[model samples]
Target: FFAGNGNFYTFVVTATTNGVVNINIPAGVAIDYQGNLNTASNQLSRTFGNEYPVYTSSNSGGTISPVSASVGQGLTTSFTVVPYSGYTMTVSGCGGSLVGNTYTTGAIVAICTVTATFTQIATAVLPTVTTGAATSINMNFATGNGNITNIGNQVNSKRGIVYDTSSHALPGNVAPASSSYPNKVEEIGSFNTGAFTENITGLTSNTTYYMRAYSYNSVGYSYGGEVSFTTNIYPTVTLSGYRIFSNINTLNVGTALEAQNTAHVFSNSGDSFRLRFLLHIANSNLSVNGGVFKIQYSLRSGTCDTSFTGESYTDITSDTPVAFYRNFFSNDQVLLTTNANDPTHNSDTVVPQTYVEKNNFSNAIATVPMGQDAEWDVSLFDKSVMDSTSYCVRIIKSDGSLLSGYTVIPEFTTATYKSRGGGGGSMYIENIATPGGTTTGGGSGSGSGSYLTKCSDGIDNDGDNKIDALDPECHAGGTLQGAYVPSNDSETVAPALPTGGCTQNCGGGGGGGDLGYWIRTVYGIFGSQFLRNSMMGSVIVSFR
Candidate 1:
């Protein structure tokens, strides 16, 4: 060491296969050993160390082989990190934020040290929201620590962001399809944390709508997603008039009034419909003893042969016979006038007063129109009679056409007695002698009595005792019984006189006609048979 000098000392040596000859120098002195000494000769020389390259046995302290230390802490404590390549041997804890580098060269040290640091990146911000023009706006939070009130307003800035309200309008501004329409929407409210419940109102009967949610907070208003819905409509019906049979002529006798027919239908729902004619009637007098009205007609054309007289009249040929029975007085005559006049007029007398006989009854019938119905009105009966009397008004249908038939009236009742011109003996004697004279005799059988004799035949050759003047039974009974004087008139006469017979020996003389004169004693067949059993002549009485 030298005074007042910051320098080092050094030494130099010359070496060969022999030994090194060193020349020492003082501190701060520069020594130059420039002479080249040859040690090739094998002469006697001092022993020198073996030839070796410039080498260092141990590195001194503070020897940083490559680079300098960085700015941040680079701790390498055993509790923190294991030693790695390029790590410094002086650190005890891991380093803080990385700043620069500090490299080393020798074999890796077994100490812990700081190396590098990681950087953080920022994310995009949520989009702004807007208020809805219609119903209340809503908002919601997706994935952030902030307000989630207005769910519709807070549109997510990132993907998977969404908001919704439970209620929505129909597609066409229409009310909901449910029975409860616009009012139903008001139940739910608007919100954020979860999906919003927005109940809108004031919707039309049938309309559609479009909407979206809106949210607002310290950040701003954010718009939600869009959606739409539709509602339902109703149905209605219309009608024309409710008139059924408003103008029916109820007072018209023997006339079947018109029935109720047309109608209208309406509906709200789209459905198919149709209708049919229905009829309802009250109590009627069209029957005997409340019996059903009779329709006396035939589909074929011909008169109904109710009488067994074998007389062929006209035939009935009606398709839809709607005729009903009616009652009338026995003396009533169905006049045949040829003119189609009113029922009250003489011109309307189609058939004159003939005793509305069986053959004199009407035969017309009627039928209703197609797709139409038929109804009847009957008159009430005052008294219940033993014999059934029927008068029919028939309506006919032929090949789909309507034709009416005349009504037929028939009656039966107790026969009444009617006085003619003479007594029993005179009438009998006159009827036997003359072909058609009465018993009121003359001196030579002259006078109206002569005419009566022509009809008075006790034999009943024509099956009519008073011998044949319009005897309906002539066409009925043949050659026996008395005459058939149809009681169409108020009075009808009996063919045989009430009293006539031979007073002596019951013979054919003595101012008496014959024994057969007493035959009138028996009225019924049993009485006549009893008379015959007694060995006396059987007598059947005339219509008394």
Candidate 2:
């Protein structure tokens, strides 16, 4: 017998043999009321002694427990249903109710079928990222920035910047390791989907670098567009101050000569001179490289001006400055001392024999490594002539560029010595007691010690009311002696002798009556000696 309801059809067959029977349906053998042709069905085999017919289940994108089972008429059965990852399940054709992952048949009377359907689950895609331009770029460090618009389906395991000296392709779908890309920086705190920053360090100065922002997750890494930035040049070198040494004496002690017109006096021609320039490095990671030093000088007829703008000078080439390489000492070790020894003393070696000359300017008299706050010393011989010489220094880099401003040069003057004739003599009058209880004779003078010279003496020997250094003749005659002293040694002259009788005592408590006797007594002693020296052809009388 055959019966049907819409697309559901059933057939009942009576068993006549005790053996099994097989049934098969070919493709397009049957048609539904909606004019849809039936597809091929699997062969069904049944034993005649079985209690009920077989129910069959099939699935796509999923699986079901108990794919086939024999059930009694008017009874129910259940099966476990499972769907693949990223899919969902459903049952049809077998009139069943599904709760959770279990599906139960409504009553089975004949052979039926169960089908499980699954559709893919929608998921999030890769994240969107952007790379920002470099900020706060300097000699050794810079800041990198990035933003993550979306984080994708997985949490980011790593996020930061990747940089290199050369341009490169985008990173692969994995976090880049140091071996593959050497320069990388990661944020220190918690990961953020929005804007973030990474402080990149250990960079080289005056170099161009390429970079990109990147983010990583289970789906792999995502990168922003490439960007480039060049670091700034090394920090500018500076001159802190300077030291001028005339042998062991420090000329500019306790004062900065650059701000004043302090004089450096040279005592003798045999003395050696040196200059120590205090150099400073503004940044700890930077250094002043190989460079040459030059000393410029000008001869001034009068006093030197306090500032460099008031004078013109030429570079010194006759006594060329020599650059030295100090072997073992650091900058702080040599510069911090009150009086640093000359660098040429022991472990120092002259680097190059001569410095570079350009445009008639002997730019490099000495070469120095001004890597830190150090004493950059140069040697100079003493001046032979008496002149007021002004000096300044200039520094040049290896590329012939000026480092900074010139060092201030003070006016240095040579000392003067007194000159006298061959046959000069000095007359001494001792034991002369003045009314003021002070003695004056063969000594410096009353109330004055050896500091009193003929020009500084208080006497008006020249008969001009102006006495000692105040006298015009004292300063007008010879060369200037020192920074503040007059050069004329013979400016003072003896006063005229008394003609009338001594109105005062002539020593020994004698009055006017004993004046003639005392005068002859003084004449008899010194007069004969003066006559004999006069006959010998030369006589110079100096009375004190």
Candidate 3:
């Protein structure tokens, strides 16, 4: 290579691979303009190199961060352009921004690089992730402060939390651009991030979730450290309850204005007993959400009945047995009113109480409504002392719709040592009519002594053709069990139950259970059974 006497000439040399390449001009390879020959050769050697498909960056007024990258082929990388002190910046290429000063490159099919121009100005930054929590089966959220502190200038930006069970990928991590979360992943957004929280919701339950607070501007998504939380698991609905009254009205005891502590329900023929018990119900998610839940009752009497296959209940063919609300007792007189707080009068449609009605078959006796408070959902029911050969009082839900999964209906069987009947016994709750005439309805045997003996009055108060013990009213223990009287009427009002209530051997099957009151009756088989288990001394024999 020589520059002739004219001026200069150009020569081209290409590098073939990675290594060194040398170009040397031999002796006399050049001549000076003054006709002087070059004594030694001017040597020029160059080294060739292979492609760097991963690393590339640039800096102008500011610095482009991840100053250099080494992520292998096929994957993407995020880069942030932090401005120098007293300098403003701009970016170009790789789907990156210079204004925001941050850029996340797409897939690394080849080398990824960017160029920027930054002017002298104040510096900027990224947003801060403050706090987060998982609250329900389908909802969770994160709170933060969004400011261009360590990040860059923000134009139209996206900010929220991206979450997963195991993966820590951002929302835009996938190639086709979706999420990698396994469950149904939805996000809460658009209202206002300035409002302080990024709501993460509509995810699955009983699962471990991973989340990262994020802000996506021209700078892709700026994420916080990965945070993890597990969702709450709600248990399914389960129905459980025991008998309300065996011998005592447990509802009137202790904090137990509700029924509790009675024998496994044992119904007796010709015996009057009141229904006073509790019901534990849960998981109404399958029921009404923000509405009142209603309860209903049905009975299957006569013989060891076949299993209830959930049918043929509410068909009271004749006018004698239409469903109607009643006071604590089964009154065909004035139906019980709904709750005083009821604005819709829903309780007017059925029984205000939840008693098990007597039936020889699958008969729907009463339907009652429940209140809103969950803890106080349990209430006591009153049975109309109706006796049947083999009867049952079963419960079910009446939400004007059907329910799913486990059987919501639980039955209480009544098979006891029968007690001789006497209508309007001590067990009668709030009866108006009379046996000897106590009710305003002017029932049989009306008298001042007669409390509410609509049954033994020998008058057909219910017009069911039956009289006293023969009537279902007597089965509630109208006569023999004596009548039910309030136990705690200020305690100053003289206990109305045992004294004011029934003085006769109502059903001849003395009382038993809570309130510790024994019914005044003839010492019969059932009476002996209750006394033997609860009162009588133990029996033993020894030989010497």
Candidate 4:
């Protein structure tokens, strides 16, 4: 039978046994309006059966458990999708539902195909971090800072600064604990981001160190840029040199007393001595400017000895020690003058005025320079009430608070001079001139005679070229008036003169007549007895 419409045809066939089926259309069976005939077609046949064909397919990323299958008509079939590692899969072509890795089609009315696909999965990456600069660096410690800009795909397990004396670069794809870095500070329970700080201690002084900020995650460790810093050095103060002046005049004359032990003597109960110190300061750590220098003394009752034992004595505190010279400047240098009271008169006699009278001198503190040796003069003692007592002195430095880490070259010991009663005596002189032509005697006698003492006589008894008050051994109480006569014939030994020539008058005395006028004028202008005396000598030579 055939039923047809315009260019359409239908055929029906029925089978009764379960067997294979083939279908084909023969040529010339149909024709178009143009009268074109179709080619011959093969025969067609079919065997009715209960099963229908099921097909399956997949993309490159995955595979199907079953390539193909057959099911009864109006029944369902399924295919398992197996995706490779780091990949995913999906199915299409057949109307299907997926559960887990399995793809199942709806009831198969005829043959249909199911497809599977796979895609690669993404992997987590390492975190990102940066190191900040070091701060508050000191001799033994410093502060380090860092920041974590990104936490990446995983939470940071730890974050902090890592430091070492030598630098260590962060390795890629390596965990912080497995890295070669020697030291690290991990902030426990700090898995978040942002800035952080750690205090690094036990560092060596004057040493350079490198540091970095780090963060750790499941992927690996991340480190910030590297930073480096150096610790500060400690400061030091050292005593370079020291000298003793027998009296104020010796100090003014730039003479240093070298005798030690009992050989160094203070003849009178009212005599005072001076101690000069040279200090060398180094390093910028100490606050030397506007700092205080102190001289501490211990007094004991006994004969002066190298070892002071068994004699208990009291420390002197009535008079504070001060610099002998005035006008101490910024560099710790002093303007040394022969005469402190009268600046106009040039003389070798030097004495520091009382601290209360000089506004320029610091009563309780002294200013010293850094990185050099500074000269300091301190009035040690006055023997007025210190009979049969021995004393020793040491120095200390301070800046608001006391300073340490200093060494004195030669440790201080007990005093070399022992004070004894009746060491003072008076002498009589025949005549003394008072800057005028008139002559007077100590006992109301008027004739000049050989009875003049060595200190007051017009002759140079020691042949050291210095006469009377001009000689340091004269000990005329820093004046040329011929007062304070010596008790014995043995003259007090004066220390060797310093390298520089006298800056002020080397001798003290009154003047008279035209010579006196010349002396006064020259002394007033030059402030140097050496200059006045030299000019006078030149005048005398010209006259001769």
- Residues 1-544 of candidate 3: C-alpha lDDT, one tens digit per residue: 4456535545578877655566775656566667665654467765455323444455565666666776544455667777777776666665544335557676555566666566776333434333245443321222322222333444324555556679644444232135554433223333223423444555444567776555544434455565677654322322233323222222221122223322334443222333332233233221112222233345544322224454344422111122211123332212222332221112222222322222211112222223211111122222222332223333334434322222223334434433232223232222223333221111122112212234332234566543333333343233323332212122112222334443532211122111111121211212335434422221110111
Q: Give per-residue CA lDDT, model 4, range 1-544, as digits (tens).
A: 2334335555576766655567777767766556655555558555477677777766677689788988766667888888987787777756789889878888777777777777776566788988888997766677899888887856788887777888777655665566666777778664766888888877776889998888888787788888999986644555444456543333252344543212234443333455554445457432222334454444443532233344332223322221122111222324433322222112212222122111122212232334544445554433222333445544455322223433332122323332121111211221122222222211211222122244432345677775433455643333333332322233455323324442112211211111222232223222345544643432221100
- Residue-wise lDDT of candidate 1 within 62-99, one digit each (tens)? 23221222221222111122223433334212222212
What do the candidate models score in CA lDDT, each in turn? 0.24, 0.49, 0.36, 0.49
Task: Using lDDT as the measure, name the better of candidate 1 and candidate 2.
Answer: 2
Candidate 2, pairs of clashing residues: none
- lDDT tens readout by residue for model 2, 1-544: 1226445555677888654678887767667666666667789776565345545556567888787777755667888888898787777655788999888887776688776777666575667689999998866678998998788855676788999999887765667672246688875344548988888887878899988888876677788888899986665555444455543222222222222223566553223344455444444323222223444555653444334455555555422221121211223112223332322212323222221112122112233332434344443443223322333444444344555543433345543422211122222212122223222212121121122244533345567654333344543322111111222345553222224442121111111112122222222222335334432321121232
lDDT over C-alpha atoms for residue 42 of model 2: 84
* TM-scores for all predictions: 0.15, 0.30, 0.27, 0.27
Model 1: weakest 10-residue lDDT segment is 234-243
* Winner on TM-score (2 vs 3): 2
Descending-lDDT candidate ranking: 4, 2, 3, 1
What is the alpha-carbon RMSD of candidate 2 to the true structure?
27.9
Clash tally, candidates in order: 99, 0, 64, 17
- Displacement of the residue 158 alpha carbon in candidate 4, Å: 1.3
